[model samples]
Target chain A: MATTSEIQSNRDLFERVARRRRRQHAEQTVFTWLLRAAVLISILTTVGIVIILVSQSVGFFAEVSPWEFLTGTEWAPLFSPQKFGVLSLVGGTLLVAVIAGLVSLTLGLGSAIFLSEYAPERLRRVLKPILEVLAGIPTVVYGYFALTFVTPILQNIFGHDQVIVFNALSAGLVMGLMIMPMVSTLSEDAMVAVPRSLRDAAYALGATRFEVSTKVVIPAALSGIVASFILGVSRAIGETMIVKIAAGATPNLTLNPLESIQAMTAYIVQVSLGETPQGSLEYKTIFAVGLLLFVMTLAMNIVGRWVISRFRQQYE
Target chain B: MNKQESIINKRQKLHAIRVLRDRIFVVGFALAVVVGILGLAALLFDVLIDGLPFLNINFLSSYASRKAENSGILAPLAGTIWIVGMTALLTIPIGVGTAIYLEEFASKNRFNRLIELNIANLAGVPSVIYGLLGLAVFVQFLFNGSRSVTAGALTMTLLILPIVVIASQEAMKAVPSSYRDAAYAMGANRWQVVKAVVLPQALPGMMSGIILALSRAIGESAPILIISSLVWVTFIPTSPDSKFTVLPLQIFTWVSQPQHSFRGIAAAAIIVLLIVLLSMNGIAIWIRSKYQSRPDQ
Candidate 1:
């Protein structure tokens, strides 16, 4: 047979090309829609999650009065009267967060200072990766470490070896250690962002290196440092495994870290992890507790954003 | 003569005080550094001593029974794998897609800003809230409607979505504008620019993020708990709809048990989890270094 080139002219080629173009165009349109759908769905899922929590939590709040939810000490939702004050849970969460926050701040800030200002470059390089390892130690491992190892230490230290079997102090301390990496990393970045010119200026003014860091760099990176602290706090509040395993199941309102107390997260796990029947009042209690946590976290996020914005404005 | 002698004495005293202060500052800083390094060293040593001894084949094959138990982590290990696998499947697509939209498709505006704020806010939300969300949504609203493996995985996907989005977006932003310009100048459409030009460049970055997030999900217990994922499974979950266990939960159960053998198993589980987490971070960092060293677009 003759070659196709000989049989087909420019007119045939034009027609074929046009058809192919239409096909490609149609395919492109489909893909665009699909991509958009995926993006929309992700956003929707995030919003949908919030909506689900809010909706179910509203159902929970309608039953338990706001005052009861906020200030009530009793939390026996499965009891005859079903009293549901969440002070104990909140108190437990605060107890843990405070301990974790304090530990992370000191360790993280100190580590940050070492990396940013003091250590030689080689040492800093070595220390940074090791520090990151400390951070990335799975939270589960932290929980176990707290329960098996740290709790024993706490017991020994407090002269309570026989007492405080399931204490918040152990859980909180380990949680703090786990979050130290987050705090240090963020704070390190902020300190690194501080211009060298500022340090030189401080030195030129006869200020000590320590003075430069605390007075100049720290103040300059105030927002970043504060942001790290807030992030660490959020982490402590959200942390579950350590508290759930080490802190025990008792949700009593107390500031003492030596006692067994149930955090909001622990309660959610306790109720959901086969302790309570599905769809029962005991189960609904998790949603109620969750709502309070959600609100607190949400408020924190708003304030964090405001702080970040204020920093940006000042810097710019 | 009196004024001159007084001035000299005052200057010497001030200099001495300055030297003392510097000495104090150095010592204080030195102490902080030592304490921080020592703290991390102590924790790692403790975990290693407890865990390294029990990392045996039997430990990998057995399941929990009772206190000071003969149990190992076979069920939980398999469950962790399933959860991480499903989570990767759910999270990577959603996270990468979100990043693409924000970085390439959508322009900066109030709507986009709101989306940005929402995402940041979501990141700050407690992981347990995500658990509740997952519980209400994945466990109840969809699938088999229980605390099945699928619910736990999907819930973790939600838990990690924000971090993934942020990481992926950073990766996308690292790509040069020249790639986009060349594609557009060649008459390539927006979708083509993204699919062909942008995504290929961004693939490694996005993969790194997914790996990190998956590693995190594997160790996560709260959301799994809220989703009602099982704790004491004797058998491996062969299906997403089946009840599952995970490394974190296993470690938790073992630690909580009032038995020495169980604590040993928990330590071993932690060691395994740490290895997995570290390996993921290593890969991401290696890829990042490679990308950075290439310098030229």
Candidate 2:
């Protein structure tokens, strides 16, 4: 039954198919490696950021003690008799962030509640995209608005003598407005995810609309809402351009919202804008401050993400 | 009978109070929505009032001058184009590839989980921190202190990489598993199945996402400002290595001027920037709407 030529031809066919499969396997491996390399780039970016920040900060700390940098009440790295107390900068950053947090949380949660529970379907459809547009406007534009428009309005309200043109209130308020949509959208998504059956159960218990929304939906979505607020505050803390433009450059330790104060981000921008030579103490100050800023944001983000994941498991 | 009447009266009062509370909430929440709408309206109106008069062809074509009247956005506009274009070219391939690796090829292992977590963290990192990273790594280390367009684009690519990867992964995930199964069952290899089935289905989504990411890049200025601080750029960027200034930076520069005239031009630049962003968003929305209703799906 096995002729010699026929057997040879069968062998040739098998070899050809095997070769093609082998080639394809090789190609697949190559492609996968290429993609893996791409993934490595992102990993490298994080590593690179950490390394650069740490290394430059090492140079900075070699000259200035970490204790003085953290607990000292003044931040005048650019002036004569350089004081590296970072608390003043931290104070300014927190003051603005706190003001922004209050505004965004109130407006953002209110809007989210309205969008999820109160607005008609048609109105919600129109309103959500409009709200999202607020998030997309450049922060620089917000900076401009804060400086030119909002500052004058603040002056009108509080009197020109009380409200300096570069007061923290204007910057904080506009920055709050900038981040409000982020909270609204995320909170709305969480609210919308709350089961309809829960709302119906509340209705069956003779709960009013307000009762149902506050007692049922909001409670169900509370963790997600809190996560959104934390992330919003994180955003407010890291915001630069608006504060750089509207908030004054003086790194005051005072809690007064009407005074000129410099945020941490604004301080970095100020140093960068000036001709601080590379590899100098002044230049290294930005990285040290950046490292601090990064750590703060990273902590909040991790907590926010953890909260979201923990609560998300409930519905899932 | 008197006690029953009093109970009934109390029930009616409770219901009335609940109704009033509901009404109050509705009005209050409606006002919150109004605040968002009114804020956007006010911003647009303010910018238009200050900017519309200055938006002319001459303003678009001229370079910056000491006099605000003669200053133009020619250099910065061209620079923005160069930066955005180069950023797209660099980001798309790497971003898409990373998504494919994580979503398609990678096993559900610790490394992949770490990658995902890292990306999430990166997304939360402030834009300014990224600027510091860019200034140190790209401008100083890679480019040897040259604030070139490539440096800026590379920085922007890294800035938006997390967004693009997340988006592309979402797009790829949206592709029906049945398509991949059919292709695989037909003796197509993994790469072949992905190329012929998944990519075609995910292309439109990925495109729209990438467009939106690019729009974000266009609006971002902090990293660019850090990378290239040359504000009074007169010549258009002719190469990847040319020093550049972007529209946001130019607007910032103008707005910082002590003179009132510069503020007018800054508003004009803002209008141009907003129009560009709106058009990009329109295209993204159009792509999403057009391709979302496929016959096969």
On lDDT, the candidate that comes out on top is 2
Backbone clash pairs for candidate 2 read none
Question: Which residue ranges in model 2 land beyond 4 Å of their true spot?
Answer: A1-13, A313-316, B294-297
Model 1 interface DockQ: 0.58
Runs off by more than 4 Å, candidate 1: A1-8, A11-21, A79-81, A161-163, A313-316, B30-33, B67-69
Q: Identify the CAPRI category of the predicted complex in candidate 2.
A: medium
Model 2 chain A — which ten-residue stretch has the worst lDDT?
A307-316
Interface RMSD of each: 2.1, 0.8
Q: Candidate 1, after superposition: displacement of residue B14 in Å?
A: 3.1
B1-297 per-residue lDDT for model 1 (tens digits): 999999999988987887787678666755655666676677667888987888888878888777444668888889888888888888888888788888887889999878877777777778878888777777777864667888888788878988898889988998899999999999887778888999999888887877777777877777776675566789989888888878887777777677576777678788888788888889987887776656576
Q: Which ten residues in a row have the lowest lDDT in candidate 2 chain B?
A: B190-199
